[model samples]
Target chain A: MNCRVLLAQIEPTLGNLSANLEMHLAAIADARARGVQMVLFPELSLSGYFLRDQVAEAALPAGHAILSQLCERSRDVSIGAGFVERGEDGRLYNSYGFFEDGRLLEVHRKVHLVTYGMFDDARDFAPGDRFRCVQSRHGRFGVLICEDMWHVSAAYLHFISNVDALLVPSASPGRGVTQTEEPGLHSVRTWNRMQEALALLFQSWIVYVNRVGSEDGMIFSGGSRVVDPFGRVAAELALLDPGVVETTLSADATRRARVMTPLRRDEKPWLVQRELTRILGQLEE
Target chain B: MNRLDIQCELVEQLLVRFLRSEAGKFGFLRAVVGVSGGVDSAVTAALCARAYGPDNVLGVRLPYKTSSPASEADALAVVQQLGIRTRRIEISAMADGYLAPNEVADRIRRGNVMARARMIVLYDLSAEWRALVIGTSNKTEILLGYSTQFGDAACALNPLGDLYKHQIFQLARHLGLPASVIEKTPTADLFEGQTDEGELGFTYAQADALFERMIDQRCGEEQLVAEGFEREFVRRIAARVALNQYKRLPPVIAKLSERTVNHDFRYLRSWGH
Candidate 1:
């Protein structure tokens, strides 16, 4: 039961909704051409990242005409990307949208609103309070945004669920690799190490896609990658361009790995409930 | 929505235009930047590279004896990942030879000396490479006067002058910079264990958000608190942004003429020609 996925590191122009959508469409078409069943893109791929107050006004319904066209265009591929979704209550959520078979499958709003380091997710958009797995012909998948993955308290719960793979749509900033003269080179290596460690610890396939190019003064390094259940990097795309790297997930391998390491047995569902309660309480306040 | 889109598109379009226009006037195709393995410099370098080209982007890693190897590695990593040429110059001897003092005094002066030394190296490279020196100071740091005025702050062009710390992060992610560099806490690396967040007494997230609400939205204290913000945090941030406003503007000068340098009417250097 091997499933192929594509990590599309597409360059997005901030706030150019039409252009960004076109880029995603091209990437989705390419993913289908490459026989990728699922393709992941960065957070806010539709409207771009850090859009200020404009995020509120830019919010669109999942059933919008343009989105419908995108779903129709990407009918063959399971496309996951970030966008500003307008919820029923009219509150905008930083959402991960799933499109498959010419239909909108699901929309998972980011729960942890990152209020730090240039992110005002809490200020403009409301946090998502639900976590549910999307059942697909390929496998059960859990989707999260950039900060949602880093929120270990929430990620641990998502990992403990019956999901076969984890997909992250991110718009992460670039830092200096070390402390030196290589302005273009990354001096830091902790984040990459963390991704590998997380994949190994969770024993689930991971797909991470990021945006490239500068907006305002921020730089996003597009080191989009796919990690196997064995925690090995299956494919890695370059930084600063629109790139696509496709690879398959062996359903047999994932099942075998989960069985051999059945660490979920030790995971306490009660603890997750308690943690979610606390997090929810804080958000409500 | 259209206005916002137009503004965003204009920011990039005009930025490219301005950088090219400036370069055309100077006859330099590339730029040299000193990335401290921090977000600001990393973003600045990315912009210069995008505005020019990776081949035209030269990064200089100037490290003092006390500087961490991680800083040097991070700098080199960015250069390699971004596909830019680089030069690593150790400034220990330069600092030691220029400043002759007791150990304590030597240490105190070393930080400033190191900064000046790094600028010297950058200027030298800018000349040799026939490139412009790109500045990395953001609006927040510049507003707070948190940067060394003439050292790391000296540059031919600063693409990030209008952005705050948080905005820089947003743009950084959009640029697809190196991930390792994107996640670390920013620091001056002037001394060991000196983090920008810790010294600033506020996280960039909090500071930048507060700036937006207060300055951009023109919200009052009551509205800010009603929005679920902490009272003390708002007070501190309000004070910080207000006090730092002066740093974000040009140095004041006496209006000696009807057309003063920066006050009445202004023109580019081309006006003099």
Candidate 2:
């Protein structure tokens, strides 16, 4: 099966949902014209990143008119957008809401709330407790927001769930200039290696959609890409500029990589679970 | 491939985009850069010319009475190079108005007063020109507290704050600024013969090398000295960085109430933009 996906690498105005929502609508219209089956935006697409105290002000309920508009647009193209979700528990979560068929389907709260360096996600929003794969009409997609991809186990969980594609949306700040090599950020280079390694390891397509432009002197590196199961870049957007990349992702690539390696078929989750239980039991002593 | 050396073309790309995006956030499409014939100001003006078209940037030359004549010529050269609009406002009267009064005699005090007076002129002109004041102070002077606060340090947005003096020179060359400005010894030019290194008692080249390893790499004091840095040099420089911490930040607010401004209540300058 082939899925036509458009990665909307946008430059969102910080803490302005209305402007960002309008931007989303505009991109959605363009995606619809392009006949994209799935439109994936970067992390915090609706609500911009670095929303310190404004996180509460920007957090939207599921029924908000802004989100409702996105859901309505989903009738033509499935949309996955990041926002500050006001949970039913009255707590806020950094969420990626997947809208399909004119309704809300999944709200993947970012499980890994980065709090170090230039981030303070854990302080402003509640941490998500779990990662659940979304079986979309186009493909089996798993969402990892920014720093979630830093931890090995987050992608491993999606791998166990047998996801066809791991949709990683990011607002990664570009830093660390290279000296001897190319004229690009070290962070962007590292992200490339990470996606390739994960795609090869999991035998899953890695759709890394990152944002562009700057906020409070922090420039988000926009180098969105789709890595095939064979760890080759299928498609990539330009760096440091707002852009959109539309390409077809082949499911056969994943099937081919998995069949050639048979790592998934030979997996033993039960033995790993038993070993984890034993290690925990021993640690309690 | 030195650590202090940077990819000049890459740096220019980032800084130019940064100026455009950061200024656009607040609905500003114009910038006011004070060209002191120094490399920092020249590089800054070049970036603004690129970000907001040359017509949008107004390069103002705020020369005092005693400021070098070569300085004004250099500033004019930069304006011609960038093809931006220019204004020559002799600030000697404004500076002397305050200087001659109260019988100010100290050279450092006189220099500081001149710097602050130039700031006043630049800011007032910024309002009239409908532009943001572009800062010329680079990271080297900023970290060393070699600048007068609210003087040349005042800016609505700074693209040069993170770059060291060496990096600034690199960018100056890449931007193709006037060779006179690029190769001239770095100076605030507050007084007639005052050089930046003369006042700081250390060359920028030595300081930038130490700063990269000390601050960027976070080498401990022992490690700094172990890496061939003079022990005394490390202590004095580290102390200056510690002491000048206040100069780098906004005034501290007392947290008397919950969610006080800057203390607890936090919002970026681009809060809604």
Off by over 4 Å in 2: A278-285
- Residues A1-285 of candidate 1 have per-residue lDDT tens digits of 467888888767666688778888888878877878888888898887867656765688758876787788657788887889998898899998888788878888999889965666787789999888777778888887888887665556668786777787888766432123322334114446656777788878877788776554455667788878778888888755567788887787677777888776666788868998999999999
**In Å, what is the interface RMSD of model 1?**
16.7
DockQ of predictions, in order shown:
0.04, 0.73
RMSD of each: 15.4, 1.4
Best by lDDT: 2
lDDT, candidate 2, B1-273, per-residue tens: 677778777787788889999998888999999999999999999999999999999999989888999998999999999999999999888888888978898998988888888899889999999899999889888999989888889999999999999999988998899999999998888888989999899999989999999988989999988999999999999999989989889998777876799867889888898
Report, to 2 decimal places, the DockQ of model 1: 0.04
Give the whole-model CA lDDT for all candidates, comma-separated.
0.74, 0.91
* lDDT, residue A122, candidate 2: 89
| Poorly placed runs, candidate 1 (over 4 Å) | A180-188, A270-285, B1-245, B249-273
